[model samples]
Target: MSLLETLEMLSYLVTIVGLPLAILTFVWEQRKERRNEEEEIFQRLSDEYREFLKLVLDNADLHLLRREGAQTELTDEQKERRLAIFGILISLFERAYLLVYEDEMDKQTRRMWQSWEDYMREWVRRADFRDALPGLLEGEDEEFTHYISQLMNEEQKVP
Candidate 1:
């Protein structure tokens, strides 16, 4: 073929192949970046949960970690502190539900969300936490209120 014709054919080949390849690569990179962002958010929330657990451990006298609650009646001051801790926990759970939970999640998103669900389930299993939930849920996100309430009901049914 003539030089000009050969050059024209190369351009056509790029238009047919390289253009679509570039578009696919761009889409793939965007998806990867989104997944990375989701992972980062999940990690930050996980760290916050760890910090909250430390708080719980620090107040071991309150027996907040116990499934049945404190063995004896708490002093007025301890009751106040325990209520405050429960408030903090409910706030964290609300944030996690708002940020992570979704009605239509991909497999990876669902997997990340499951850990948070388990945490909620564990806390809800505690009788004290369940008792405090209604007061703590006041003025929180509506969807989160509904979600956790459902979880509380489900946990209550478990033996």
Candidate 2:
């Protein structure tokens, strides 16, 4: 073959080989970027969940103290504080739900999410958590017990 023709054929081969490699590199980088984003989201959710659990536990502690025949009366101010904290807890749970059950979430994480939701609903129902904290808490010791168990389960995966 002529030298020019040979060179042209070699250039064609190079293009064919380089195209897929370039495409593969682009795909790999895209995947890595997505992975980094997902990791950041997971970490943020985990941290927020930990903080939420802490607040819930604190609320439970206050409830437990009152349940033990220790000053069960909650003033309006105290009730407002409890309501504020509980509302924040609910918001955290909603965020965590979105995080853990995001479109790409794996099966195990989805299962944990189902459990979390069920536990939250159960506690809310048993204690009528939507009602006035003072009156509900005075007679809702069992709900606190259930809450502790759910918190333990939720925190089990944390380091």
Candidate 3:
């Protein structure tokens, strides 16, 4: 073939192969970046939950970790503190629900969300937490309120 014809054929080959390859690579990288961002968000939320647990541990006198709740009646000041802690926990759960939960999630997203769901289930299992939930959920995200309410109901049904 003439030099110009050879050059034209090379351009055609590139158009047929390189263009689609480039598009595929771009899409793959974008997906990978999105996954990384999601992982980072999940990690940050996990850290916040750890901090909240530390707060719970610090107030062990309140017996917030107990499934049945405090053995003794809480003094007024302790009641106030316990309510405040419950409020903080509700806020964290709302944030997680807003950020992580979705109506239609991919496998990776669902896996990450399962952890938050388990946390909510654990808290809802606590009688004191269930009792405080209505007050703590006031003015929170509507979807989160609905979601946690469902969890509370489901947990209540279990023996």
Candidate 4:
């Protein structure tokens, strides 16, 4: 073929093949970046939750754990503290549940949250927690309440 004819064929081949491959690569890179951003957000959320729990454990309010099921009545102060602690916890976990419920979360993020599940179950099983939960959840989202109820039921059956 003449030089002009050969050049024309090469241009056509590049347009047909190279353009699509370049477009595919660009799309793949964008998806990967988006996935990385999502994973980072999940990691930060999980880390913040861990840190918050650590702070809670460091507080003296943990005496409530022992008093939770006791016949002794908690003072208004103690009950307020309990509500505050659990309120923080529920909000964090509810954020997680909503994210997962909507399928915006991936398994790796779910696995990261599994560490908190035991603590969550333990607290939800507390008598005071259950007693106060209905009132606390009254203003909350229905889906989150259902999710917490499901977690509670599932945990109760696990032992």
Candidate 5:
């Protein structure tokens, strides 16, 4: 073949080869970026799951101690300490629930919370444990009452 024809063929070959390599590089980079994003999502979820478990375990410990009447044998200061622990447990449970399920919580999450609610109900019904819970439930009742009253006031104002 003539030298000009050979050069033309070589140019065509380079374009075909270089175009695919460039496209392949772009696709590979996009795939890598997607993988990194998935890893970040998995890491965030793992951190959330760990926090949830910690809250559940802390609540269980505090609940069990109060249920067993271990506080009665201790001094008043010890009783206060136990109450503080119970308060911490409740606060942690509330915070974790809000973090994990801000708006649309899943069924498994609601089921987990329901289990905790039933346990709390049992605790509230126990005469010995009732005193331990008044602190946790007291502020909540007033908040609910205020919310209901505000709704009523707003309705009256409307009509």
Candidate 6:
């Protein structure tokens, strides 16, 4: 074929093959970027959880309060302390529920939530926590409260 004709055929082949390849590469890159973003979010949430747990574990009173809660009528100061602790816990759970609801929680992220879920189950049973629940729920995100409610009921149903 003449040089012009050969050049035209090459351009046609590129349009047919190269365009699709380019499009696919672009899509693959986008998927990779999206995965990286999800991973970063998951890591940040996980790190925050770990650090908080470490802080509680490192403190004797905080650790006791978290594990057994109040065994008797608490003074106003104790009540306030319990409220603050639960406030932080519930807020973290709310953020996590939102992340999962927003489709940001991958398999690893969901797995990371297992401990939090277990804690929720146990926390809901605490007398101090039960006392605090009503006030805590009053201002929480509706969907997050609903999620916790389901967990609370599930824990209740178990023997």
- List the RMSD of every prediction in angstroms: 1.2, 9.1, 1.1, 3.2, 10.8, 2.9
Candidate lDDT scores, in order, read: 0.94, 0.58, 0.94, 0.72, 0.53, 0.72
- Which one wins by TM-score: 1 or 6? 1
C-alpha displacement of 122 in model 4, angstroms? 3.8
Mind giving the per-residue lDDT tens digits that candidate 6 earns over 1-159?
999999999999999999999999999999899778767776777787777676556544534344466456666775666577677777877787776444355576567566567767777866566667778888889977887888777766776
| Clashing pairs in model 4, backbone N/Cα/C closer than 3 A | none
Off by over 4 Å in 4: 1-4, 64-73, 102-110, 113-119
Tens-place lDDT per residue, model 2, 1-159, is: 999999999999889998889999999999889767766766786677677667766766346223222146766776676667655655555555555554465765566566556545544543324353344334334545454445545544444
Error of 3 at 69 (Å): 1.5
TM-score of 3: 0.95
Off by over 4 Å in 2: 1-3, 56-61, 64-73, 99-159
lDDT of 3 by residue, 1-159 (tens): 999999999999999999999999999999999999999999999999999999999999999888788999999999999999999999999999988998999999999999999999999999888888899988998889999999999999999
Question: In model 4, what is the error at residue 136, expressed in angstroms?
Answer: 2.2
Query: How many clashing pairs per prediction, in order?
Result: 0, 0, 0, 0, 0, 0
How many Å off is the CA of 65 in candidate 1? Answer: 1.4
Q: Candidate 4 at 64: error in angstroms?
A: 5.8
lDDT of 4: 0.72
Instruction: Count backbone clashes in candidate 6.
Output: 0
